[model samples]
Each structure stands twice: as C-alpha cells, then as structure tokens.
Target: MKKEEKLEIKLNVQKESWKSLWLMARRYGMSPEKMLEQFVADLTCGAGSGGSDERDLAERWYYRSFEMMGEDTFVSYLCSDEDMIEEVMELKGRITKSEQYISEVKKRIETGERIFVHYGKADKKSLIAATWEELGYESREAWDKECEEEIREEKEIVSENEERLKEIWENFQRARASQSATYEEEMKKLDEFLEEYGKSFR
Candidate 1:
C-alpha cells in the first residue's frame, strides 16, 4: 500500500495502568515503553486468533501514534479513567482481516526473493471514514486548529462534549439518510435499545 496521509490522534499513557501493561511488557524482556510499542505492532498485525483486514486496520489505528484526520483536529477532553487502557488492549485483540490491502511485499533473502505473507492490508474499510469526512469537510484540513476553532466558535463552545456528541450523532444521522445501516430490522432494534436504555438515563 502506498503511504497515504491519515488523521492523527495523540493518546496519553495511563499512569495508573502502566504497571499492568508493564507486567506484560517485562515478560517480553523489554522496557515498559519498548514492549508497549512492540505490543502495539503485534496487536495491529492481527496477533490474536481474530484475523484482521489489513487495509482498514491501518485506518483504524497508527503505530503507537494516534490517528491523523485532516488539518483541523481538536481534542475536547481527557479520559481520566484507568480502565480505558484495559479496554484499549482488549479491543485491539478483536480486529478483523481485510482483503482490500496491498498484496505485494519486498524483502531481501540470502538465496533469492522469498514470497512471504504480504503485509499489505486486505480490505479498504477506511474509505468509509474518509468518505464520510469528505462529505462534510469543506476545504478544511482534518487536523487544522484554525478550522476546529471555527467550528467551536460557530457553536460558541457551550461545551466540547456537545460537539463530540454531535460528531457521532451527525454521522449516524447521515448514515440513516443515506440508508447505510437503517434497515428496518436494525432500526427496530435501535428503537428497542433506545426505548429500554434511553428511558433509564434520566
């Protein structure tokens, strides 16, 4: 796969859970930081039983670094919970394989070029996100502070949470209008979840 620009997301290492991740890290005979890096690489490479679509997997995560969007990106809050790290670890193990990935890989062997498993991703699920953003991002870089500021100003910063919430709500709303996942059965299930869970939130 050719190198394509991606949205970057910076995440802080959870200090409290560092010990636990470190425990796993030490078993590999590496420092906490180094082992964590390797762990991240393996996790993305579909280490566990769950196979992953390599093409879309690249879209979902970066190597140790957060994902990159266009230029006007903004972080609205921090996740203070220690459990978030555990959640991330668990989630990383469940990634699926893709077929839209690049199939050619080049490696040097002593005798000749050996054909090994091409690390190219097998799927292009990332297009979904890129497409959705392209639909609404008008001349705005996905990671630009200026554009994010403008969006904040337009909403007057009543709360960053409001914007984050809407970011998801808007996508689902768009998906619904576009008939992405608005099949009657799914919608009915959603309605059921809403009716059951929504009524309890208050």
Candidate 2:
C-alpha cells in the first residue's frame, strides 16, 4: 500500500477554548493536534471521497425544488437555517406586523392623509394621497399647495424638536457627569443603549 501523505493545518480558535481543548487532550493522553486529527477522522470514517460530491448534489436538488415552486421559495428562505428557529420566528413576526401597518397606512391614504416618511437627516417628505380628485381637492394646484404647506409645517415642528433635544442633551450630559464619578463609563453605557435602540429600527 502507498503511504498517505500527512499535512499539518493550523486552526484558529478562542484562547480559552484552545486552552480547554489542550486540557481535554491531556486528559485523553493525546497531543491536542493528534486528538483533533483523530476526532475529524472518526467523524468521516465511513464517508468515501465521493461522499462530499454526492452530498452537494443532493443539497442542490433539494434547494432547486424550492426554486421550482415559487410559492414554497419564500417559505424556504424564511426557514433556511433550521438551527436559528427563533430568529426565523422573529422575522415572520416582523413581516406580519409590517403587513398590518401597511394596511393601516393604505386606509389613511384613502382617507386623504399624507403618510410622512423620514429619510435619515434629509428634508421631510410624504406619500401624497392618490390624486387631487380622490383626496377631495378642487384642483391639482390646490393639492400641491396643501402638500407643500403641510411638509413645511412638519419641517418647522421637526426643527423645534431638534432644538429642544439639543438643550435636553446638554443638560443630560451635565447631570450625568455630576452624578457619576465614572463619567466615561456612563457615556459608554449611553452609547450601548443608543446602538441597541438603533438596531430596533433596522
């Protein structure tokens, strides 16, 4: 029989995990590298070299079935990672909530309400109701004027709130600094809180 060529491969893992693995190897009376090699060999002992190719082909067809059926494709995408069932449920829940919100927004628009949309720090905008006639406006010019006025009023309200927020932020900074000996730690906590809050919108 021909001798199999052995190759060395470096595996990067967390420091604590690597230490624990070495401890386990010591307990088993084997070098860490040998233990890992044997562990992997045991895992694939029954699989021939063609096994991976066959597995890949099977997976391809399994996914292709979902693609062929348009209706099931979306469901498959949502359930793609079976290990992350909770994440999938959360995504489905968000979709349901969004559908409900869109229905409400549609009704509001039908009733001649402009749906305001905030885009980052840009000028305020809105989805103007369908048409002048549908929105009960006498003319397109009148509808346009009303939209401009409403948008302008909303911008002014936003500007006022921004100024109020600036003042409140300054006061908050002073208060937080005065209350905490670890002012930097307090600020770091605030940063963490803002990051989590922003993630909710995403």
TM-score against truth, every candidate = 0.20, 0.25
- Candidate 1 regions exceeding 4 Å error are 1-11, 46-202
- The alpha-carbon deviation from the true structure for residue 16 of candidate 2, after best TM-score superposition, in angstroms, is 11
lDDT of 2 by residue, 1-202 (tens): 8866665667889999989999999997988887667545544442232356655665566557756654322222223444433443343345445555555545544554442332234333323434456446777567556655655555555555445534544554554443432435543454454355446534
- What's the lDDT for residue 25 in model 1? 72
After superposition on all CA atoms, what RMSD does each candidate show versus the true structure?
A: 25.8, 20.0
Evaluate residue 82 in candidate 1 and report its C-alpha lDDT on the 0 to 100 scale.
Answer: 28
Poorest lDDT segment (10 consecutive residues) of candidate 1 = 96-105
lDDT of 1 at 199: 55
